[model samples]
Target: MATLNSDYLIIGNSAAGVTAAETIRAKDPYGTITLISREPHHVYGRPLISYLIEGKTTLDAMKFKPETFYEDHKITALLGDEFEALTLDPEAHEVGLKNGDSIGYGRCLLATGSVPFTPPIKGLQGKSNVFTFITLDDAEQAWAAAVEASLKASESGRCSRVVVIGSGLIGLKAAEALSHHLDEISVLELADRILPTVLDPEGSALLQRLLEPHGITCYPGLTADEVLGEGDQAVGVRLTNGECLDCDLIIAAVGVRPNSSLALEAGAQSGRGLIVDERLLTSLPDVYAAGDVVQVCDVLDGSEHPLALWPNAMHQGKIAGRQMAGDETALFHGSFAVNAVDFFDISLLTAGVINPREDMGCEIDIYAEDNSYAKFVKQDGKLIGYILLNRPQNAGIYTALIENGVDLDSLDQDIFLETPQNLDFDNEMRWERLHKFYPRDLDRRGWKEKI
Candidate 1:
């Protein structure tokens, strides 16, 4: 039980924690900074785990920064340490740790992130071969198990199959990875379509077509009733429709829930995630929260939602870091829940508000084709949301318009009605907004030179 003292103490060391450290160093280079992480490895991009499983990249390449990032910034690193509790003392400006140690901090950040939510299906417990793909360790174990299952089937002359329970990004990636080695692969989703919260029906159809060529079967609108196992190892799963599929590997990608238990125990306000203000500060003073562990306001919807995107986490972390370092230079402007996915030969990108309610007095416009579709939602003369499929080049432009609340009423509605290719930005209003956002590009194009 050792004690530590630092000007800033950060718990968790993935996207949010790492960004916070760099931001703090950027603002206050002389302050003592301590970062604690339960992971043994330094900061690495978690999204690359799927590529690693598919043998597309090596572990070394996935390092977020460099091995010496902490040392280079004169920051103390604590690896393989879990944050068990948080006890704040306002008068002393100190926090108590579960390791029987205390840290005296002028400011503290909670970036504890989230944990995979594995539903309690019958026979799921005590299964040796069932795994979840979340952490690096989780990916390592799943990859190893997949390899072993493949080898055993080859040596013992048995069929190898894998059932992935979820149709979200993680589940799809896992199914793709297992499809490379397994004899058969199936994805089970309780929702009516894949990527229910992200992609619409047409977008999901394109994805399904891409997966079919790779021998991945998707069973949407189906729920897992039980994990069928022989002895201690999972052998298959029983579907709610009374269908049993034989599988040697089972990867649970049901989704994730914010890990806010410590914050809750510390009397911090908790909703779907730790509630934080615009400054990323929690209800408690000198205590801040970010990353997937915090519920942030959706700038578009004006409702609290969990933005689990990596970029959102990093941005939130930077804001929290700056505010904690005594610089009120930034605010967590919130996230638009943007996400992109590339599988097989199809690529999809979506951002901002989605699925506008028909009764919300919003106008919806769509341009659809067999290969692509662009949908835009306008409310009160402002662009609210957009969905782009197959065509990704103009996504940035649409995202900017929606995020900046650019007025679209003056522009010709026919521009959005036509195919994205037929659209032109010659309109004064559109050009003005576009140039404002891309001033450097405009300068490079000599458009600003004449002005």
Candidate 2:
């Protein structure tokens, strides 16, 4: 096997990988950087896959960065199945590929995101018209299948339908994307409500109401028992309650698990996910892991788990890159969950511990009027979580409060009663935030609080 060497080697090519490559180049312009990606395409916004199927965005428009990004950064990208990292030899500092080629690196980063977790259900094996929503290719194939199914159903004078298992963000988004082509879309979630992980019961109900008008129906507290099929193609699904719903397509959006096997086999420590320190260094020497592959510290609950959120991955990539480039000060200070998404015409923004455990002794306040709803969760007089639906104005203020653990008593205005603003903070905090690195010797009262 031929071997190539690089100063820095990064695996995966999504948000975290791309960001780390850019950061490394910015810090060390002369280092040889080699990025390996199993994906054939250039780096694009993974979140935009549904938009691509919805016709809201084109393939070219989905590119997260400019087309010449790799060339401009002078970084080598080994993409497609040929360059897939099959093995990691920590002692040898090399990664083996399927194509009988290996890459030796001085320092390596594993940003190998996550993979969809498909549960064991009868008739799922060797089935046609069944898919998972994750990669761009998945979206493309699903869109094509939807078009074919719709055409066949239209010719037969029947409504085209799709049954999606799991009503989390991925499943719901898949339903929304296929709604335009199919006559009906049903989301089956075993949980009691949609978006169970991101929203509270009330918020999930509100979003479900919004979704119904768009021909997307959610079935909570129900799951598919078996995928009923006809000649290798899925014709319908039998629910756990013994009801059968016919569908032209089946989308399994169950969940995702970190792709940490490569690092684990190479002797990296793990607990739920690959364990990395504050600097993103794994147990293996000269090896680091970031993004969804590593379990990171959650500032809210003081627990370590894989945060698959995109922004968190980007932040981890930056810290990992900086640390790899010999900058000791660059560190990851932990993260809290946050999600902002829009469905049809309505928008939802949530942050932190929206669903605190009953034993945690957190206080919650909720306000609802018509289509707008706001809920805040606090612990020890500090903001920790919030849900804003249709009342998204200045929602970042709440997020900042949660991230920084700002004390409610320190503010002069009531954050819950009105929309929060910068002026809500006292004069000293206002200056410290507005000009974060401004001279500390300057007058603290210069920026007067208007509110």
Candidate 3:
């Protein structure tokens, strides 16, 4: 096998891995850094793939970093290659590639991201018209196939139909994009509401209504038992409620499961994701994990959950890279889920635990109107969580307060009604927000028992 030597080998080329490489270059200017990915394209925002299908942006515009990013950082990129195994041992610490080659590393970071969770529905795979809206290639193929399907209906003057399974962020974004391309777009969610992971039922309902004008219909509380097809082509989707909807194309946006088995098989600690301590190290020596593949402290209830958002991945990657470069003080400040998405003009921002259990002793305040909705959640008089829609201007301040535990007792009720000004915050909080790192765990209250 051909052997490639490196001081740092990062598996995956998106946010976490790339950020890690950048951070490493700052510390060790002469060390060799190798970043690999299954995709051939340069790193781009995964979330923007849906917008590419919707015709809002071109593939070139999707590039998050310039082409010179790797060259400028003095990093070697192994794109369009799949990682097969970790050949770390006494003799050589390296990663095996799908091809007959291995890239040896002094320290390896596993930032391999998640893959789409394919639901257990019959006749879903091997269908030419079926696709997952996750990667850039997935978006390109889905859009090309959808255009071909549209040409078939040119004589009939009817719109091609697109069914997006799951009403989470991926599903809604796909539906929104396909609505502009096809005649009909329907979102089928197994849950009763959309964005169940982000927004509560009330916020979800508002989003559903806002999406109606975009020519997209959402069917909640529906599960797909089978994907009906005709001779290797997807024709319709069969739901558990005894209804079959015609579909020219289907985009599976159910959810994503962490790609942690590689580390687990290599004998690393893992649960829903690769488990890590404050140092972000795995069970094995000289091996660390970051990004969507690793579980992080939620800090809300002192639980570990996959904060798969891009920002968290970038932050974790920086910390992991610093730690790998010999910074023992690089401890994780903790993370929770935070998502902000705009669909056809209706902007939604959800941070932390939106709906805390009643037994958790959280105070809830809601403001809902025709086009705006905001829900604030607090524990011990400090902001803990919030969900805002249509009104996203001052959303950052609210999120800062949640992470830093700003006492809500001082703020007037008008904080929710308008964009909160800097004067609204105490001088200390304002200074930290503008100058220093916002302290996430400086508060006195301890972790309470989960109800």
Best by TM-score: 2
Candidate 2 lDDT, 6-41, residue by residue in tens = 999999999889899999999999999999999999
Rank ordering of all candidates by TM-score, starting from the highest: 2, 3, 1
Q: Looking at candidate 3, what is the lDDT of residue 5?
A: 87
> Which 10 consecutive positions of candidate 3 have the poorest summed lDDT?
441-450
Candidate 1 residue-wise lDDT, 329-358, digit = tens: 688777777788776566778887768777
lDDT of 2: 0.91
Model 2 poorest ten-residue lDDT run: 442-451
TM-scores for candidates 1 onward, in order: 0.90, 0.96, 0.93
Better lDDT candidate (2, 3): 2
- Pairs that collide, model 2: none
